[model samples]
Each structure stands twice: as structure tokens, then as C-alpha cells.
Target chain A: MTFRAERRGTFRAERRGTFRAERRGAFRAEVRDQIAKWRRDGVFEPRSDSWLTGYDEDFSRRLGARGWIGLTWRGRGFADRFVLTEELLRAGAPVAAHWIADRQIGPAIARLGSAALKQALLPGIEAGDVRFCLGMSEPDAGSDLASVRTRAVRTDGGWLLDGQKVWSSHAHRATHAYVLARTSTGEHKHRGLTEFVLDMSAPGVTARQIPDMRGPGHFCEVFFDGAFVPDSAVLGSVGDGWGQVTGQLAFERGGPERVLSTYPLLALTLAAAGPADAGRVGELVARLTALRRLGKQVAARMDAGEAPIGAAATLKMLGNRFEVDVIEVARSVPGVPRAAIDDAVLAAPGFSLRGGTTEVLGVVIAREAMGAVG
Target chain B: MSMPDVEEAAVKVLGGAADMRDAARITAEQGWHLLGVPEPEGAGGTLADLTGVVRAVSAAGLSSPLPELHAPVVLSVRGQLIAPWGPAWENVNLAGEPYDIGDAPSSGAVLTRWRILHAARLVGGCQGAAARTAAYAATRVQFGRPIARFQAVSALVAEAHAQAVLAAAGLEAALADPEDDLVAVAALATASRAGTAVARVAHQVHGAIGVTQEMGLERLTRRLWAWRDLPGEAELEPLLGLLGEERAWDLGAGDE
Candidate 1:
């Protein structure tokens, strides 16, 4: 298989009165080569079973040297690497370990961190030495995100933090967690919450891992008991965390990671179906192609530093349907014993719920697509 | 390449941002995506299951499809193939077969449903055709290696894909559109023919294995044969027989 030179402007913005598909000059080629090298070196390896995971520190060092961990901006880890992340996730590479810093923390820090904070944190990200976990969702506040009751009130030289966070992915072994805390007591709701960088090893912060259905523990529930973050640790402004959180969410749901989970299975299925399945495979290819087209459109918008939220939701919904269908197709192939269904079965049920639930996407289409004119 | 087993499946529990009032709210809040199901638990369901659910919502009358299903889900997301035809269509007659829902539906309208059903039958037919072809080529021997290695036998298998593609698309459209049209029925007839053609050719290639239980061609072909008759061929039988009898036609003409 040959990797094409990274191409940009592959998808034109509909907003541009006449958007034609075009290649993104030398910059795209350079990116394409970099991605190829990353792929060859297994920079986007499939988390646990990856060939690199075997050697531990050596792999981490290699990753650090290549800037796979902190892809953009010399001192700002996640600044430029957002595209790499979208690519890796879409490619179905295991990014479980650094999932947090790359998606949530890095961006938050780059935008809000002081000169002092940058030096203490960024190197660990470059070297993959600092694994971070997210602490956003709470038992009471699931998708009603503003309901986060985890509180961090002002204190001398620091802030006293206390609250609980559930569904925090990869917390047990992480070096730290970027948590959302309630700073205001009133019902300003979204306006009341704040963001914090919590030291996982601190005496008061406790993280207990939650075992996943078929795999190792990927998520956890963390409880903060009088955990203290000095004034330097608050993420963004105390009252402005809502904007920060939304920005983080945009990063969270806007990528290919949500659709390529079963990529290996797809590859295997295609290989097995062979010449007889050429037609069926062609139909599948069309769906995949459409998905890529849409995805690229959204990515291009982001590259230009625009929010394509509507398109992102649409992509997420599309990705959910296609992802679930891909798994179901694998399940339907005859002769493989039921035991072989594996994660395909376990993951399919939640396909609609993940990312933002397909239902909400329909709402987006309705309000934005249909209601926009009205 | 070898075929993956049909029945094996793992569960993937998924949820999506939910706000039935608007589908996107639900989809976004629920974390709906196809890959890496953002859901906390469970395995996957078929496209038919999920799509069927949406169609059911429309049929239930709890919501008007115009603003909901047709507006956002179909026309907006799936494009205009699903646009509403307005109030003109209510029934239709084709090739002397008069199928009606007691209302005056234009042939274009009624045929749309048939088109969808016909497509489903065709999909089943395509799969059956491919399986039968494979079974035949796998067993028949010539020049020391199985005849499957020969280009002639292989060509039959390739042909099934062409037939299967038509069937699959027809079925997909029928399912996607969800209407009662003759196009769906025609699609079924086409599928049956395509599937039978593939199976018969495969049997000729296998020369015995095609009939064996172990080989499974019989199993595949049987499904194709049965699906060809879906949506009440029996319903059509009386209507067709009555139309064929000249007395009613002549009587109606004389009265007119």
C-alpha cells in the first residue's frame, strides 16, 4: 500500500461560493510525508497490543523525539498536532495513553497557561512521560455538563478542590488530570464551573479504575478530597471555564477516531471476501468515501481555525451509523462461531450513544439544516 | 479471499445525544458515532434495526414525517430522493396488475414501495448466488486442481456480484425509502432471476457438491427462491386472475 502525499484543500468549504476539490500545495505534501513516517514508525499504534508498547521507555523516547506526542508548536504540545490526532484516531491507532493531554489539557494550557506553567508541563507531553486523564462528567451531571458540582474555592496561595468525577478515561495510571470544578455557588450554572490541573499523586486526589466490559480498565471515577491547586493551577479563568470546556468538546467530537475502531476487522473482511465480494465491497467503499469527503471538509474548516460545529455533529452522527453498521456486517459474515464476535458485539450497542448520541445530531440537522431558513 | 461467517457478532451498546424533538440534539448528547462507539457499553445493531426504528417513528403518527423524517433525516441528510410527492399519489396499476390501497395513487407513487421490496429480495438473491457459485467452484475438479481454479468457473462467481449489486441497491433503496411501490416488486422479480441464474450456473460447475448439505448451496438457493415471492404473490394472484377474465372488462365497458 502506498501513502499519498498529504493533500490539503482536498475538500472545499461549501461556504466558499464555489468550492472545488483541490490539492493543498507543498504544505500538504510535507504533512503527507510526516504522516507516512509516523504510520511507518507505528506512532499511531493500536494502544495495548502495539509493537511499541512492549519496550516501554524506549518507545516513549522515540515518540518524544519525533514530536508525535506534542505535535504542534515547539513549546505548545497540542497547537499543531490536532490534525495528527484526527488522522491517528481516524486511522484507528491506539491513543489511549495521551488521549487527554492531546485533546483536552494541551490546548487548554497553550491558550491559558502562564510562562511558568509551560516549562513544568510541556516536556512530559513531548516525551509521552505525562499521561493525563479527563475529569469532566459526574454522576449527577452526565451530558448536562454544567451540573458539575466538583468545587474549587479560593484559598491562600492555592484553591481547595473537592468533588467527584465519573467516566474519567485512563485515570488510574495517569500522571495528572485536568478537572472541571464548580467555582461559583449560584445557579449561573455554566458560568459557575472552573477548570483545574490536578496532580494525581497529590495526597488528597484519589482515582479508582473502572473495568470495561471486554477490555482492561480504560475509565475511572475520581474523588477529590481537599485537593489543593495553587493559583497557578487553574485552567482558563475561574468564570470562563465554560468557553474552555466547549473548546475542549469541539476537539473531543471533531475527528475520525469515532469511526475507525473496527478498521482491522474491515481490512480482514475485505481480504476474505476477495473477488466475489468486489461489488459488495464497492458499495462499502462508496460509503467510506463519502465519510472521508465529509470528514475532510470539517477538518479543513478546523485547519483554517473555524468551528464547523454543525458539520462536526453531522459527521459524528454519520460516523456512528457507519461504525455500527461495519460491526454488524462483520457479525453477519457466515461460519465464524459466535465466540468470534468479540468487541464488535460489545461496542455496537453503544454506537449511537457515543460522541453525542445520534439523536442530538438529528436535532442539529433539524434546527440547523431545516430551521436555519425558517 | 475466504468469506467471514454470517452469524457471528459481538454486541456494541451505543447511545446518542437524545432530543427526539430534534434528532441532532439526541445524536450529539448521546455521543452517536459508528466507530469507537462513544457509548459506555454493549455491541452493535444492524442498519435495518436503527433505520427501521426511524421509519416506525414516522408511521406511528406521533410526528409528521414532513418536518421530521422527510425534512431532516431524508431530504436534508439523505438528499432529495425522499422528498414528499405531495397529495396527488394514492394508488396504481402495472402490466395489467391493479394494486390499490383504495385511494388514487399514481403508478409512480405506488411503484416506489414495490421498488424497495423488490430490492430486498434481490439482495438475498445476490448472496445466495455468490454462495452457490463458490460452493460449485470449490468442489469440481479438472486437470488435477479443482475446477474453481479455472477462469470459466471463476467468471460465474464474478457475475454474481453484478447481479448482487443491483439487488443490494434495490433493497437498500426500498429500505431507505420505505414506500409501497411496484418498483420494489419489479426489483424482487429481477433479484429472483439473478439469484437463480447464479445458483444454476454454480450447480453446473460443482456437478454434485452444489446439492450437498455440507456444501450449503441448497441452503443459500432456498432463501433466494423464497424471497422472490414476498409481499403476497397470493394477493396478486386473485387480482391478476380476475383482471385476466374478460367478462368484467367487457361488462364495465358496456356500462360505460
Candidate 2:
């Protein structure tokens, strides 16, 4: 009887595997068809780093209506999300409006947000009405995020936030901002930090767009002068924001976005690649293939409830390099549009800077490597 | 045995061998070369099983004919194929490893197989180099702290480790579908490129000691240099050009 039961279990597992694979295939096909149609209809122009630069609420709403946003929160797997995002980034879709919310914050809130917070924000997030901008990096806390001086003080039924967040992308248009502020003094720098979701239009909140080389960019400096956030808006727990924010880094850094930020330029490069340029283009594709596989492995690990922090850092490190290298390869190939190359070149610097700087990623990866050896 | 157990066994057996000749003999006696051979004639393990033994041997920094033991003869101008008992011109590569020069028939499939195995070796070499470099960086002290504390040295170690990870990923993809020539070529190209970067960074972090034979970092770095250019990125990269844009984007489609 036990042997028969085990055999039946194995059969069920096999069937589940097959079903998952089929679902993934169908979903990927659907995404490809939709992207092709969008291109044909002039829905959005393909651009490098569209995840950051492209802000089309309508496009995001369409994706949300198709149930592509908040995939993991909706009982879909990371592999499914991986397929969706890979195709979206490959086509350089206008995903920025919903990117931060959908990519990390939505999942975070689902996992750790208060009941009221979930009821208030998750539906809007899934429907593409709620957009989120990060408030982790402050003027003095670029790489050392633990040094953020943003303070959140206790109040009657909420907290009063007083600080400034720099390089908060899309804050000007985001409906919400996820900010990390210190609530109390603790033994270490990583302590006393708390993450809170603040309404963008709160009375004391102000967002000022910072013009960059790209001109009228999404970069913003957000100031909170006694902005009020209810206790329900707190993500995770007080004094544990360090752990929570670090946990989100794997999701932020490991995705296909890190690798495919410059894929539009690569597509253009491939169209213009001559026989002589084949070697160069082929090299880029080979690296991309490897990086994508690594990404898939990371996603699979995440699905299995593993953080895979080191693996994620390694992916971003190599992926950031690949993202920048695509520009040079594009430049070398004749007939690749000059405007595309210029856009990629201007966007290339931030590929390694955002999420985590290359230097910071190197530290993380090397420390992991050292730990393994020891 | 499981794949990791097979690799562990290979490492244990190969570790007992004194030199390349002894290692080759042990490999044959253990039937590792016939791991993927057909039943009755030899053990019928999967390609993945053979990969375990290949990775073990290469990671041990031992130069043997294990990877090519069952492979069909392919051209070797610098003479990497070892056949000591056969009548051939014995030569040494950049790593000072001996190989034999002889005319032999070659097949495209066999070449791809050889490339896959060699790419695995390169992947192993990169891992070995990266591990050793990282270990050294964490222990070797300067300016009252380990050099790894220095961001520059940390960057070097990270580069080596990252390259190893990338190369290993490529090898995994190729192993998944070894029969696919495009996949094999891409894997080899990625591994070959990684080998150069890993070797360079390993040497840089080890400073002058990395070059000396006594220090033993040369064992992996030299092999990396020698194996890297053998049908390296330059040779394998062009094959990827055969793929059109759509196919290139969608290569290894069903497997994913």
C-alpha cells in the first residue's frame, strides 16, 4: 500500500511539472503575440532602460488588465513572472509606471503588510492604479544605505516623517513611495530603521524632478517635512527594515531587467550586423544566453523560497557589464541608428549604478566567494 | 551513484594519483572514460554523469586525456590530444602539458563534443582559479588588513568569481542540449572568454607569486591560457552568426 501511494505521488508530481511547463509555454506565446501587436500598432517606441524611462500608465493598465502585474501575489510562480518580464523588457515596453510596485513592493506588501494596508493598496497595485517609487537612497546614503537620516517619529495614530530621498525615480508621478526612516536609536547602524509606504500627495510631501543628461528625466528628490503615514502603512516590522530591504535586493537585482536593459539596442544591432560583425554580435548573444540561464536559476531558487542573495549579486554584476557592452557592440555595427546608440550610451552609466553600484555588488559577490572558500 | 558522489569519487581517486600518467591510468581503471558509453561495452551513464568526472579532473588542476579519452580525434596544431603509447610527435603546450601530434579523422559532432568537454574544463579551471584567488585575497594582508578589504582587490576577486559563474552557466546550457551545435559553440565561446579574464584577475590578485611554479597558481592559470584559445571565442563565435535574429533570440527555446 505504501509503495503504491509513493508511486501515485510521483505520478502526480510529474503531471504537475508538465502542467507548469505547458502554462509557461502558453503564457510566453501570449506575451510574444501581444508585444508584436503593440509594435505593429505603434503602441510604444522601443527604448533602452524603458523600465526606468518609459512611463505609460495606459500601457501598464493594459498589462494589469491582462493579469501580468503582481504575478506572484496572484498565485503565479516566479518562473511565470520571469517569462512575462523577459518578454516585456525584450520589447522595451513602457513598464516603469508599474515596475517598482509590481516588481518588489507588491510582493513585499503581500508578504508583510498589515491587513488594512493590503486591503487598501494591493488591489490598486494589481489594477495598475497605484505606482511606487523607491525612497531608500538618500543624499548621504547612496551606497551606505544604512546611513539614511530619514526620521519617522511616533504620533497619535501614525508617524511623522522628516527627511529627504535622492534619486527616487518616478517619484513625481508615483502614487506612493516606499521610504526607509529611522524610528529610534539602536546599537548598530542597520538597526532602528523602518520601512513605510507614504501617499505621494500627502500634505507635507514634496517631489522635485532632477534634470539629468537625458533631459527632464524621471529622477526626483523627494522631501518629507512632517509627512504623516499611518501605522497600517508600515511594511514588515519596526527596527527590521534593514533585513526587509536587503531581502528585496535579490528580487530587484536578479531579474531579466538587469540583463535586458539594453536589449533594444541589441535588437537594432542584430538587424544591422554584417558577416564581419557576426563574431562581435555572437559574443554578446552568448554572454546574454548564459546570463539569462543564470537569471532563470535565480528565479527558480526564489520560487523554492531561497533568497539566493549571492547568485543574484553575481547576475547583476555580469549583467550590468553585458548591458553596457551592448552599446559598444552596437556602435561597432554599421546601420544601427545613431539615436538608439546615444540613448543607450547615456543610459549605460545608471545600469551599474542603480539597484546597487558595481563596486557594492563586487563587495557582495567577493564576500560570498570568500565565505565559500573558507 | 549520484552526480556529486561521482564527482567526489573522481576527485578522491584522481587525488591519489601522483602525476598525469598515473591519473590517466586510474581514470581508465575506474572506467570513467566509458561513463557515457553504451551498455555491455561500458557503463551507460548520462552525459551529465561524464560531466561530473570531467569537472573533477579539471578542478583538481590535473592535465589528463580524460576529456578526450572517448572523443574522436580532432585536429590539434599545438597538440592537446595526448597519446603517449602511440607513434606521434610529442609536444608541449603553453602550460607545459604533453600532447601528441597525429593525423586523425574528425567529425562535426565529435568536434562539438570535444568543445563541450574542453569548455567544461575551462569552466572548472575558472572556478579553481577564482576560489584560490578569493582564498588568497581574504588571507593575504597588506596595510594592516586583508587585501580583500580593499575595494580594488575585492573587485578583482569578484570579477574572477563572476566570470566563473557565467562560464559555468554557459556550460550548463550546453550540457542541457549537447547535440545542439549552436549551443555548444556559444558555451565554448563564453567559457573561453571567461578563462582569459579569470586567469588575468587571479594573477593580479596573487601579485608576483601567481606567476611562479612554486606558488602553484600557475597550474590553473597556465591551463586556462592554454585551453582558452583552443577553438576559442574567435573560432566558435562565427557559428552563432548563422542564427538569424529571431532564432538567435529564441535559441534553446523549448529547454527553458
Candidate 3:
């Protein structure tokens, strides 16, 4: 064997249990099923028209028979969906809608929704027939999200929401968008914001999808032009938005989906190559082996309902860096080309900046881990 | 895991006393009876299997570390040491700190929990080597001469090599016979010293790469520090003291 071949041949001689693909749940199984179907059948690829538009009405309703959405809350079946989320992201499924609802909407309602409020709207969301978007960051309020100036005037009829939300992923597609509005001034920046599930179809709400350089059109600018909301629309208590959003953010930040986004493409890259790329494979194995374990640790924590807030943030940051590293490493292999052919690398370059940027996540880790922000 | 499995296996092997701690010292130095390392009995396994079930429990999200360590002691009172059985064994622990578990970690229940901390010490058994290499590798020159040389690089590898040696010595010593000697204590000290330093030096060598997200060295290093802080640190001196006391006791018994 040549020098390069020798290195490649001995790459994995010392390691064991290298692969990290998970198949632990029915939900995950269904996701695996969908992923297989999508790849083999050449299923729906995202386009301009299909991006914000809801799925076929009957198709969506049919999809809800098994209750794949919101599977792990109380009174619900123990079908956990985080693994489902992980699988979907790994498959590169257009899970933007599901990500929004599962990440933000479901938790907001379950925690703060009034009994009547919960009874009326939750089943549709639970069934995936309806979707919700988060309205957290404003144009000026990127990392300082609490600096949002959205106002909800308490009039005789109900709340009159007049605010603008930026970077609202899936705000245009959702049936309802859970929004954060400032009800009253408080000493703390995070004190006054209140979380509300706004009916996007209601009068005066405008959502337009905006294109971004990294991966255009997953984000939007949502404007509530005196959007009328009944008192029932308030999720959690008024002025309890800060606490509610914090809890929601913790749930959002900590999930297996954050780590396994580009996994399928990685599998594809490996499958296409032969034995010449052995040493690279060895390094990848060691990395993903430890990473999978760390992801499992965080997942176990989330599954147990103990939001490892600090630890989760640490994982999120770690995962983004790891993902970026994998991309760099994969691109350098002798067999692989400099640029992706089917647009894999360029398609999701901004994933690191999504959900929460690595820098913002650093502050979170600092506050919760180091106990500095008192 | 090794602690408990070896402790129980120690009782089963030299079945004289329930407190394998007394008998374990002789087993530690005279030969390699401990799991993994080759010995006269010729039985061996990894840390995972020896302490398998208990460690499995901890790995599967249970809080207990190694129940086997305490199990032998728990059963010790039942066997009277004066009337010997197969082989008389003595054990003297050389950990550097007490369990400090708020309540005494003296009972079988507590000792098992304390061992988890001990097991964590093995997590990044040689992280210091990685760090030691990264520090210079990032800045060091090659043929012109700074000495990172490659991705793994040598200085850190040597540093980790030393750390692994310490860990090996510690593991070996923990299984020694109850002969009441310094070799066993030295083994524990050697392992602790090496294990702790390996993690530090590995980070030092690796520089920013050692702790960065892409860095594979952080968890090992973190686990080393975490394991080092375990209650075992307090136990070392006491174990050494016990060795001195046991030798006196043995001499007294011999006179009788």
C-alpha cells in the first residue's frame, strides 16, 4: 500500500462503535420511513410557491392520524418527538413548520394557556393541522430580544397588537404565530414581554418571506397592524411573557435536532467514496462517536423534563462548531470536490446562526454555568 | 467499575474475609489478580465488565458508582478472619479524600455511590497529553523547528503516554494484596499524579484546539478534573495510614 493508502487502511483499526445513527422510537421510525421515501421517491423539494403554503388540506389531516406532532406532553401518548425532530433534520425534511410548533408553540400553550384556551386550539396543533411561529427577535433586537417594542393595548374588546417581528421563520406559513408583546414597563428588560398566540389569518397581520444569503426564505418579517386578539389569545398570564419565553427558549435551545442536521448528507458523502478516504473516516468516527454520546446525554436530560439549560446551551454551541468543522474536514478529502454538487454545503451555511447564534449562546452558557449575570 | 468488580471478585477469589479491603492489598502487589491485567489466576476483563452491572446502572442514568466495592465489605463480618479460608487477603485504600457525601459514605450503599466519582476519573484518562501538544502545535514550527509536527503531535502524545502510565499504575495498585506495604499506596499516588497531570498537559499542548468545539480533548480533560475531585482523594492518606496500622496489627498477631 502507498503511504496514503496505509494511513487509510489503519484508520479505524483501533476504534469501535463509530456510527451515530439513532432508531430508538416509533416517532423516529416514522421519520426514518419518511426520509427513505423522500430519498427514493424523489419527494417534495422546497420551492418558492411551496415554502410558505400549507400542505394539501386532506393530506395534512391524513398525516395527523398517528399524532406525530406534540407527542410527549401530559395526557398525550408517550411518543416523544425530539428524536423525530432529529431524524427529520438529518433527512433534510422541510421541518420548518414542525420545528416552529414543537420548539415554541406547544410549550407556550401548555404552560400558560387558559383551560378554555387550551381546549379550543391545542388539538389542531397537536395533530399538525395548524402551525405556529415565534415572534421573538426584532430588527433592532437580535440578541437583546427582550428589547422588542410590540405593544398589546388592553381595550374593551381585547388586545390590539401593533408590533413588527423580524427573523420570524415560518411566520408566513403558520396558521397562528405565538408573539411576545410588552404590556408594561419593568425594571428588567425581560420583565414586561407577554407571550400570545396570534391568529395569523385574522385582520391586520401581514407576513412576507424575506430571502437571506445563507438559505433564503425560511425567515420572514411579520407585522401586526392593530391585529385584534381576544383576551383568550393571551398565553400564560399577562406580563408573564418574559418567564414564559425563557422557559420556551430553554426547550427550543436544547434538542437532538440541533446536532444532527447535516447527518444524511454526511452519509451520502461517505457512501459515494471508496477506501482511499480511510484516515478521514477514522477522524470523523472518533469525533462523531464522542459527539453522539454528548448528544445522547443532552437528549436524555431533555427527555426527563429537566431542561439542562446551561448544558444544553453548551451542546448547542459545541454542535454548531462541530458541524462547521465536519464541513471543513469533509470538503478537504481527496475524493470529494471543493464545492458541493447538489448544493448541500451552500444550502445550509447559516444553520450555525439560526435558533440562536453561537455568540448569544455563549452569554447564556456564561450566565447559567458561571453564575455571573446576577 | 474495576473497584467494585475487583472487590467482589477479590472476596470470591481469596474468600477468607468479607472486607476484601484487608485482603486486597496482597492481591495488589504480589501479583496481577485485578481484572484486565494478567495475573497468576489468568482472569482478565475491562473496567466496564468487572464493574459491569453497577457501572451499567450508572451509565443507564443510575447514581450509584460501584456497589461491588462495598459489597465485599458488607459481607465481611460474616466470615471470621481468625479461622482462615482459601487465602488470607488484606486491603488498604490509598484515596486522597473522604467521600464527603454530607452523610457518611461508609455503608455499602454510600461506597457504591462514591465509586461513580472514581470511575469518572477514567473518562479522559490522558487528556493532558492532547492539551500539552495543542499548546505548541498551533504556534510551533516544523522542519525549521517548533514541534507540533502533526495533528496528534508528539510532546502531547508523550505527556498523555505518561498520564496513561499513571492510570495503569493506579489501577494496578488498587488491586494489591493486604500485605501492608507502601507499593500499593505508591501505585495509587502514581496513578493519581499521572492521571491528573495527563489531562492538564494534554490541554497545554493542544492550545486552543484542545478546548475548542472541534477539540476532542475537552471532555476527557473535564472528566479527569471531575474524577480527581472525587471523594477518593481524601481516602488515600487514610488508606496509607491503615497500611501502617495493619502492619502493626499483623506484627502483633504474629507474636500471638
Candidate 4:
């Protein structure tokens, strides 16, 4: 009887596995079909770094309507989300509107937010009715995020935030800002930090556009004179922001976005490639193949409930190089549009800078390597 | 035994060998070369089982002719078969490793096997070089501190390690589907590129002493250089070109 039950259980598990795989495949096909229809209808145009530069609320709403956002929180696995995100990135779809919230913040809020916070934000986040922009980097704190000077002092209902955040992408349009502030002095700079979710329309809050070399970009400088964030808006715990934010780095760094920023250009280059360009194209494809595998591994690890920070950093560091190299290869291909090449070239500089600079990523990765050796 | 067990066994057998000949004799004694060969005529195992031994041998910086031995016939890129016992010309590669040249029948199957093994060697070489470089950077102090504390040196260490990872990923993909010619081609191409990049960063981080035999960094770097261009990146380009955009994307997605 025991052996029979065990065999039956194994059969059921296998069936469940098959069912899950079929569902994932169907979901992927549906997304691809929708993207194709959108392309045909001129709903969106493919572009490089669309996750950052391309912000189309309608497109985001469409995805949200299809139940693609906050996938993990909705009981979907990271592998399913991996397929969705990879397809979206491959198409270079305008995913910026809900990118930040959907990618990391929504999950963070679900895991650590107050019940009141979840009631207020999770629904809108799922529906793409709300957008979140990061307020981690201050004028003085780029790589050294622990040294952020943004201060949040206790107030009547919550905390009063006052500080300046630079390079807050899409802050002007975002409905909310995920801010990190110094709450108190501690033994180390890494301590006394706290994370808060603040409403963008709060009193004494302002966002100014910062034009980059790529012309008017999504980059913005956000200032909080005395913006109020309710206690319920605090993410995780007070003075635990350092650990919480660092924990999200793997999610931020390990995604199809890091590797496929210039995939649209690569497709174009491949279409235009000649015999002379075969070697270059092959080299790029080989690297892409390897990177995609690494990205998949990262997703699987996340699914297994492991925060693969070092692997993610490694993927980003090498992936950033591949993203730039694709632009160069695109330049050499004959029929690729000059404008697309220009856009990719301009965007190439930021590939290694955002999230964590390549230098910082190197430090993380080197430490991980040394740790392995020891 | 499992793959890791096979690998551990190979390491134990090959770890303290004096030279290439000694390693080869011990590996033969252990029947490593016959690992994947079906039984009755030879010991029974699978291609996956041979991976660990191949990786272990190459990672140890010994040129034991294991890859060539595993194949039914060894052929050069020019379609010349490698003679088992002797060479037409006495030659050594850039790493001072033996380069066989002779006249025999060439086989595509043998060439593919050799390419996969060589790619695995390159991946192992990159890992070995990167690990040694990281260890050196962490210990070699400059200006009152370890150079690893410097972002410049750390970047080199990271690059080396990342390339090793990328190469390993490629090798894993190829091994997952060895029959797929495009996957094999891409794996070799990726490993070749990574081998060179890792060697470059490994040397840059190691400095002048790295080139010296005493430092021993050259052992892996030299093999990387020798193995990387054995078939060369250019040779695999045409095969990769055969992968159309959709097929190429599918190759990367690795969706079964």
C-alpha cells in the first residue's frame, strides 16, 4: 500500500509538472501574439532601453490587464515571469511605466509592507494604475548608497522626509517614490537607514526633469522639502533599509533587461548582416546564448528562494558589455538605420552605470570570487 | 558514479602527477580515456560522464592528449587526421604543448567530439586562470594594502571570473544538446572568446611576475592561448551564421 501510494503521488506530481509547463507555454504564446498584434496596429515601436526610456501607460495597462504584472505575488513563478519579461524585452516593448514597481517594489511591499500598505498599494500596482520611481541615489550617494543624506524624522502620523534624489528615472510621472532616508545616527553609515514609500503628489514634494545627452530623458531630480510618509508606508523595518535594499539588488540586476537592452538592434543587424558580418554576428549570438542561460539560472535560483546576488552581478557586468558590443556590431551592418544605431550608441554608456555601476558590481563580484577561493 | 564523483576521482588521480606523460599513464590506468566507450570492447559510460574528467585534466594545466584519445579519430581543421603514435613533423603549439600532424581519414563525428572537449578545456582553463588571479590579487599587497582593494584590480578579477562563468554556461548549453551542431559551434566560439579574455585579464592583474614560470599563472594562460585558437573563432563563424534570427533566439532561450 505504501509503495502504491508513493507511485501514485509521483504520477500526480509529473502530471502537475506537465500542466505547469503547458500553462507557461500557452502564456508565452499569448504574450507573443498580443505583442505581434500591437506591432501591426502601431501600438508601440521597438527601441533600445525601452525599460528605461520608453514609458507608455496604455501599453503598461494593457499588460496589467492581461495579468502580467506582480507575477510572483499573484502565485506565478519566476520562470513564468522570466518568459514574459524576456519576450517583452526581446520586442523592446515600452515597459517603463510599471517596470520598477512590477519588477522589485511590488514584491517587496507584498513581503514586508503593513497590511494597510498592501491594501492601499498592491491592487493599484497590479492594475498598473500606480507607478513607482526609485529614490535611492542622492546627489552625494551614487555607489555609496549607505551615505545617503536624505533625512526622515518622526512626525504626527508618520515621518517627515526632506532630501534631494538625483537620477530618479520617470519620477515626474511616477505616482509614488520609493525613498531611502537616514532615520538616526548609528555606529556605521550602513545603519540608521530606512525605506519609505511616499506619494509623489504629497505636499512639499517636487520633481524636475534632467535632460541627458540623449535629449530630454526620463531622468529627473526629485526634492522633498518635508513630504509626509505614513508609518504604514515604511518598507520592511525602520533602520533596516540597507539590508532590504541590498536584498533587492539581485532582482534588479538579474533580468532580461540587462542582457536584451539592444536586442531589437541586434535583430535588425542580423537581418542586414552580410557574409562579411557573419563572424561578428556569430560572436554576438554566442555571447547572447551564454548570457541568456545565465539569466535563466538567476531566475531559477530566485524561484528556489535563493538570493543569487553574485551571479546576478556577474550577469550584469558581462551583459552590459554584450549590450554595448551589439551596438558596435549594428553599426557595421549595412542596412540598419542610422538613427537606431545612434540611439544604441548613446544608450550604451548607461548600460554599465545604472542599477549599480560596473565598478561597484566588480567589487561585489570580486568579493564573491574571493569568498569562493577561501 | 555521478558526474561530480567522476570529477573528484579524476582530480585525485591527476592532482600530483609530475608531468603530462605521468598524468596520461595514471589516467589510462584508471580507464578514464575509455570512460564513455561502451563496454565489452571498452568500459561503459556516457558523454556527460567524460565531461568531469576532461575538465579536471585541462584545469590541472596538463596536456595529456585525453581529448584526442577519447575520439575515434583526431583531425585538424585542415581535414588531416592526427596519427596515434607519431607526427609527420615534430611540433609544439604556442603553449609548448604537442601538436600532432599526420595522414589519416578524417571524420566529422571525431571533429565535433574534439571541439566539445577542447571547448570544455578552454572553460576549465579560464576558471583555473581566474581563480589563481583572484587569489594573487587578494594577497599581493601594493602601497600598504592588497591590490584587490583597488577598484582597478578588482575589475580585472571580476572580468576574469565573469568570463569563466560565461564560458561555463556556454559549455553547459552545448553539453545539454551535444547533437545540435549550432549549439556546439556557438559553445566553441564562446569558449574561445572567453579563454582569450580571461587570459588577458588574468595577466593584467598578475603583473610582471605572472609571466614567470615561478608564478605559474602562465601554465593556464598559455594553454588558454593554445586551445582557444586550435580551431579558432573564425572557423565556427559560418556554422553560427547558419542560425537564423528566430533559431538563434531560440538557441539562447534554451526552451525545451
- Rank the models by TM-score, top first: 2, 4, 3, 1
**Mind giving the per-residue lDDT tens digits that candidate 3 earns over A83-179?**
5555555545555555566555776677678887788777887676777777888887767777979998898857999989988877777788878
Each prediction's RMSD over C-alphas, in Å, is: 23.4, 4.4, 18.5, 5.1
Which candidate model has the greater TM-score, 1 or 4? 4
Candidate 1 segments whose C-alpha is farther than 4 A from its true place: A1-61, A72-92, A334-341, A349-351, B1-256
* Candidate 4 segments exceeding 4 Å error: A1-27, B15-29, B33-46, B73-90, B102-110, B252-255
Name the candidate that leads on lDDT.
Answer: 2
- Indicate whether candidate 3 or candidate 4 has the larger TM-score: 4
Q: Which CAPRI quality tier does the interface of model 4 achieve?
A: acceptable
Question: What lDDT does candidate 3 reach at residue A343?
Answer: 45
Question: In model 3, where do residues sit more than 4 Å from their true spots?
Answer: A1-39, A45-63, A74-79, A214-216, A334-342, A347-349, A366-374, B1-256
- Stretch of 10 with least lDDT, candidate 2 chain B: B80-89
lDDT on C-alpha atoms for all candidate structures: 0.49, 0.85, 0.50, 0.83
Kindly provide the TM-score of model 3 when superposed on the true structure, using C-alpha atoms.
Answer: 0.58
The best candidate by DockQ is: 2
lDDT of 4 by residue, A1-374 (tens): 11111222112122123234457668788888989998999999999889998899999898889899999889987778888998898898999999999998998999999999999999999899899999999886667878888999999989999989999999999999999999997559999999999999999899999999967789999999999999999999999999999999999999889999999999888888888888889889888888988887898899889999999999999999899999988888889899888888888888998989988999999998888786
DockQ, every prediction: 0.02, 0.33, 0.02, 0.29
Top candidate (TM-score): 2
Residue B72 error, candidate 2, Å: 1.9
Q: DockQ-based ranking, best first?
A: 2, 4, 3, 1
- Please identify which of the two predictions, 1 or 4, would achieve the higher DockQ against the true structure: 4
| Model 2: CA > 4 A from native | A1-21, B16-23, B37-42, B76-89, B101-105
Error of 1 at A344 (Å): 3.3
